[model samples]
Target: MAYEVLVQSVVDYAIYLLDREGRVSSWNPGAERIKGYSPGEILGKHFSRFYTEEDRHADVPEAALGPSLGGDIQFETAVP
Candidate 1:
């Protein structure tokens, strides 16, 4: 589909889809390039792995599930 093509072509921004439970449902090329996880390794995994320990302890991931208006949530990560 056109959307898949666009997501695959973009390399600057990581574009992915997470299920309602925060599980990674779709992994795009940009996501693999930026996050360093191939789809095989990351697909169906909980996205909280990207959050810092403090963030996880503070329930930041839970808070990030805000209104489903399709917006972005900026967070600090421990991954280098």
Candidate 2:
């Protein structure tokens, strides 16, 4: 629970929750900062909004979620 709260307080990385149906069930300050959307503006919206228009239209957002939820996705960050 405390971890959840800490994540909620973040202002980076666009943290969010997607239900089984792939709908956004929650939004956090980080989401607002990275996505330019406030919680009130984006809650209940599909998590695909973070993708480019072409990606969304091609369902690439769904594809990304699949591996992520399956624990087969890995993210690497490099600092320049």
Candidate 3:
């Protein structure tokens, strides 16, 4: 389907889905570029792996998700 092809071809932003528990459920090429993780390496892993240890330790990662899912949070990071 065209939708599937479009999703597969995306390379700008890391397009992915996470379960309520924050585990990575899917990944695309953009995810590889943004996160330095291959789909094979990241699938089924906790999305928190992208966070710094201090953030994870403070539970900030989990807190951020609440706002993000509610459209109350917007993240802007420089990738380079």
Best candidate, lDDT: 1
Better of 2 and 3 by TM-score: 3
What would the TM-scores of all predictions be? 0.79, 0.70, 0.76
Q: Which whole-number lDDT from 0 to 100 does residue 66 have in model 2?
A: 70
- Estimate the TM-score for candidate 1: 0.79
How far in Å is the alpha carbon of 62 misplaced in model 2? 1.9
Tens-place lDDT per residue, model 3, 1-80, is 88767877999988898987888988989889988899889999988778777767876667768865774654443223
For model 1, the local distance difference test gives: 0.83
Give the number of the best model, judged by TM-score. Answer: 1
Runs in model 1 lying further than 4 Å from the true structure: 69-80
- lDDT: the better of candidates 2 and 3: 3
Off by over 4 Å in 2: 68-80
Order the candidate numbers by TM-score, best to worst: 1, 3, 2
RMSD, each candidate, Å?
3.3, 4.6, 3.1
